[model samples]
Target: MSVLDFDNLTKRYGRTTALRELTLSIPEGSVYGLLGPNGSGKTTTLGLALGVLQPSGGTVRWFGAPATAATRRRVGALLETPNFYPYLSARQNLQIAADVKQTDARSLEAALETVGLAQRQREPVSGFSLGMKQRLAIGAALLGRPEVLVLDEPTNGLDPQGIADVRALVQRLAAEGRTVIMASHLLDEIEKVCTHVAVLHQGQLRSAGPVAASLATADRVVLGLAPGTAADVLRAALSSLPFVQDVRPETDGRVSCALAIGHSPASLNQALFAQGLALAHLEMRHRRLEDQFLELIKN
Candidate 1:
């Protein structure tokens, strides 16, 4: 089931259209990433879906219905910077958040432990690292055990260790059977943690699907012939195969081509061998997510 759906959802600010006709459905139990560079409407989309900002056009639905107060309660969000009293302990901050949410403090212990702040719950927020504070903020969002989490650039300004902490925390949250919708400009972060991704550029949807499938669209199978074999012979053989496409020569004296749908590297190798051409090297060059992201937004 989709935890959230956006049907041609759009947001405009005066003369500028921040988000345009963004239609997407976030599947339940999946870690969905909104991938784009700055000013690409990632935040605008999140704001519209969370009801923090009214859409200029279209609809935002949560759990197949309009976002009501009850439905909003089922979603936990860390939209921007984490706000906490500098002098308050982590536990105290969560207490304040609970009060704001009108939720009981009964779940504080579990939330603290889940974010790995139980041991340091008593430490003053001023003494905690940025990553710790972020986790504490996430703990606050966990006050009522929401079924979905929405995080925007959860690792935006952290050191390597802090980024790692938040990444691990996100993974842990998804493992507990909750849907996590994260927005980030970092291609590596999205590629590493997201099960599915939607690429946005200039407020328009570029591509959306399972991460592997999206990247697979650009994958190529590289073929290298024996040292004595003429390169033209290899190219000629590839040109004759109906399943091969985009045949190109690599600078390293090797040939690369994309295989058609339902075809595999093993099948390609078998087909080449049947044509009396033995391959000295054959490997699948899986395209990086960064390459795919750049290509999507380049235009």
Candidate 2:
């Protein structure tokens, strides 16, 4: 069943339109990604869906009805940078969250443990680092044991380990049958955690569907470089190749570049070899979520 539905939802600010006829459904128990560049209406969409902003032209339906208290109880969101009382300890902050969520206060410790903040629960939020604060924010969102979790740029200011932590937590949530919707500009992060993705551009949805299907729809091309050249040097040279769309350098002197004009792997290698580039690493490279995202935005 669809846990969240946005049907022709539109929002505006003065003369500026923030969302344009957005229509999508997030199925229950799936990790959905809301992907777009800055100012692409992702936050606005989340705001409207959470009943924080009223739509100007359409409706956001939760559980097949208008967003209401009952529906809100099942949905928890960490929109933008989550704010908390800096003076309060993590446990105290979560106590406040429990009150707001109308859930049992005893669940606070469990929520803290879920986000890996159990050990730091007594530490004041002010002394916590940015990553710790993010974890606490997630704990607050989990206060009610919500069936649906909505997080916007949850990894915005974290180090590698923090990012990994959040990613693991999200995966664990999805594994446990919770519906997760993440709004983020980090395409790689979305690729790693999201099973489905919605791409938005200029206040309009460009695509909405499974991540694998969207990635497969993208054109693929491979370029093989001669041996002896450093990967960086080969990447720079191949990037200058005609129709070469992107270049990702791997370990060793191996580089893969996608061609804008979709061609078979063999054809790509033939073209490169014709240009005096030797064939060492020749295989079709899979398109990353960022590649598909940029393609959507550009078109």
Best by TM-score: 1
Q: Model 1 off-target regions past 4 Å?
A: 85-89, 119-129
In candidate 1, what are the lDDT values of residues 146-219, reduced to their tens digit?
89999988886667876887789789889998999999999999999999999999999999999988887889
Scored by CA lDDT, what does every candidate get? 0.90, 0.84
TM-score per prediction, in order, is 0.92, 0.79
Error of 2 at 4 (Å): 0.4
Q: Report, for all candidates in order, the number of backbone clashes.
A: 0, 0
Off by over 4 Å in 2: 219-282
TM-score for candidate 2, please give it. 0.79
Candidate 2's C-alpha lDDT? 0.84
